[model samples]
Target: MSYRWLKWLILWIPTVVIGLWEYVRHAFLLPYVSMELGNWLAPVFVFLITLTLVRRLFAKLEAMQDSLKRQQVVKAAFEEREQLARELHDGISQSLFMLSVKLNKLDRAQSEADATKAMEGVRHTVRHVYEDVRQSISNLQNALQPADSTWLQSIHRLSSELEQAQGIAVTVDSKLYDGLLTNRQKVELLAILREALMNVQKHAGASAVTIQAEHHGALNVPVPAFSCVIEDDGKGATEEELQELGKYGIRMMRERAKAMGWKLNIGPSALGGIRIEITGGGASG
Candidate 1:
């Protein structure tokens, strides 16, 4: 019950009992002793008790209201951070992409000696700035929203971009089960694949590139997992190149696999190039 109702009931109970007692004593037993001072003090005592109870209740209510306001402020701050991240990714990121493309085009134009040297310096600066902006946008976007690309889709898009932009022939084959990979895993795999493919295009000088994906079951084995293998037939790596790959593409692939709790294998391809294999699934996957 409310404090107000409880307080009133407590004050009324004694008054009712005393009034009945006085009536019975006067009518059947003896005349009741009455005091004007006691009558005046009864209301004073009740008033003091009621005031004390009300003051405590109000203090508790004000504390609860303050707590709620603090929580609301925290919620608002979190929402603002998310909104700022989104704006940076969607707006500033696109502008940087456009700027990078224009700088690349300017760098490609044949020019006089002095002009070429000046453009080279500009290009170098622009490239560094582009890298920084891209990384910042990627970090912010990752924090604000879940990745939208699937493992298969990320690979497909990267392949298409490389082919269109760099004249590399790329193909994909897969029987991917949709929604079978987490967003973080998908993005990491895509980054590894892009690095591997870029190495092939820039150094391998291969005329054609092929990508294939198939389900590999590890039933009755020590570790049960699904496997994905990517192979390319191109200029094979030298021993020195193989060693350096650990500092380059192989390291990226390993980190991505580790993050997803996967086992990764990198070796020479049967067709005389490189082969990368990864196996695992995240909890959501």
Candidate 2:
């Protein structure tokens, strides 16, 4: 039954039934029914009503809730598929088109110098396409996997990707506890971290990068505040340079943090490169 029907069943049914019973007992059966017998009959009436109606109604409600949860899961699956389709179209498809154009140019070159330049362009475009494809596959894999995967595992995966793609060294020092971030929080935090690392890969020109995360309050606390820092030992950005090359990624990260009501900071790192820090409260999902 619907919630309103259930509510009426729970509230008004019992009140109306008991009121009618009491009225009959007092007005019509008072000469035959003793007060003690009436008192005992009242509980018996309530018991019969509960056993015959309330129990079945509650079972139906539970079943309805379960069915709703299943539908939500199916809806979420469809949405994920749609998102993957868009990513393929926007990223991998465009990169493949560029790769095809470069191949055409390579094939039409007239001179040795022109051919060599075109070949180099083709190679660059091919590499770009490969990276885009790899990233899409990784994202799809992550989406299909279970939510129990920890932030450390995600960071390690990103580190592996950065190392493979950019030949950069990555070190991770995470002191934040697992099982303390909601799924939404994990997604947002990972997106911010991924963007920050991508900026380092594209602009830092550094050999090594470090990701450090730690809880902010007492270690023994059940739910503590936390912070994450991503930095590199590369040629650091002056404010002006950040405004030029790293602006898009930095702004995206800042927007994510703001959406989550967290704090995001960008500044020069002690490692002589850019530092991106995120701080927020931590609680179990």
Candidate 3:
């Protein structure tokens, strides 16, 4: 069945044939035999058995290596999930609780107020706080969820949220096809994009941003690659600043691209802002 068993069979077949021939010769031609001939075959059979046992032991080692790889993947995913959960609970949950307290105080104050006008103001304030909390929770959940769609769709959703949160105009022109990237590539790209946008929110006083995707020729004939570019219209970073901050966000982008055998470009935009571009080709689904 297995290669090891086949090997043993091959080794023993010659010995079996020789034994059969010797028996036929003794019975018919020679009409004489010795037990010592039979005793010599026993050592060869024992050696073949030892070889088969060693092959089985190596097969077990290969199985253990496969198991270790699977365990490592599972552990990494679990750690990511836990980190997201802690962020949500510590940051957004605390903000919501504070808002709730303020709302409760306002409700009590309104009960003692002079009429319909006070009630309307209280209701409006409550509604705004509720909407803000809802949106904050939604964004946190979106960031934590596993990416299950096209790269284009994921970037589009991310841009839309940034537009709403920061009051900036965001646009996306993605042409990446669905199901063309491996799962690991998709996840790493998503993290890179998120980190880039976070840098924009923290440092760039940008009023507008745009993202685009294009296809290019691959190294080999008839193969194609995909590229994505994200640009912003904000005050561009100083060369020194770029060099410093690049160590974290931009470096991450580069490493992820390298791991996938892709290309990543990051620099100042022509419109006095920053741009990040990523490219990869011949990716299997």
Candidate 4:
């Protein structure tokens, strides 16, 4: 059954049936059944219905969690494929272009020694390209493996990729404030982090990046708040540039924050790089 249908069946059916029974008792069976008996039976019926509903809800939730895990695996595979595509386009394609120019030089060489040296240069370029392909493949293989942690797993992987592939230093500091986040919150927050990191990797040219997260709340609030900050040491963007077309995924980030009713700020960090800070409502998402 659909969740809504099952919920109505489990929670309301008993109450409705019992209410009808009570009405019938007063109308026609008043002498046959005691008021005390109906009183005791109402609680009993409600308790039984609630128990059944709780069990069914938990089972459905478990199944949904398993399905989400499978989806995550598929997403990882697609992400790795994208990574391979970028590596091929950026690294191997450029190398091949350079190699072709060298090949032209080899064809027009002056003498045997020059030809030999040209051949050696070609071999060197070919070997480097081969190693680059091998590394990309290995990275893809490793990235497709299952994760055994929370949503922070992807964040850690992103940081590691930046450090290893781009030679940038990254540090991630995340904590569950009063508690963990819902699946919706995790997904949105992960997207925000990825976009922020991508902007740094593509444009910041910062030597170091730091990601910090926390969940906290005020004294009167019943739910904990969610917040994160991404800071880098790269060149920061100007206010004028931020309004221009297609600048550092700024529009996408702003839209995401708006959809979630989050307060987002983008500006220069103390280290002269861009800083992105996000704060959202208590029990966000």
Q: What TM-score would each prediction reach against the true structure?
A: 0.45, 0.65, 0.54, 0.57
Residues 1-285 of candidate 1 have per-residue lDDT tens digits of 554665666567556655765565457645343456445555665556557764565666666668878986696467446544543443345556756766676667677765576567666556645544554454345444445746566667667755754576777887554455445555555656665675564456565677776544533443334566667677777667865643444555676578668777777788677777776653312
lDDT of 3 by residue, 59-104 (tens): 6656766787899678667745653554345334544666566556
Candidate 3, clashing residue pairs? Answer: none
Provide the clashing-pair count of each candidate structure. 0, 0, 0, 0
lDDT of 3: 0.65
What residue pairs are clashing in model 1? none
CA lDDT, every model vs. true structure? 0.59, 0.79, 0.65, 0.72
Worst 10 residues of 1 by lDDT: 215-224
Identify the runs in model 2 with alpha carbons over 4 angstroms from their true place. Answer: 1-110, 198-205, 218-223, 234-259, 282-285
Ranking by lDDT: 2, 4, 3, 1
Ranked by lDDT, the better of candidates 2 and 4 is: 2
TM-score of candidate 1 to 2 decimals: 0.45
lDDT computed for candidate 2: 0.79
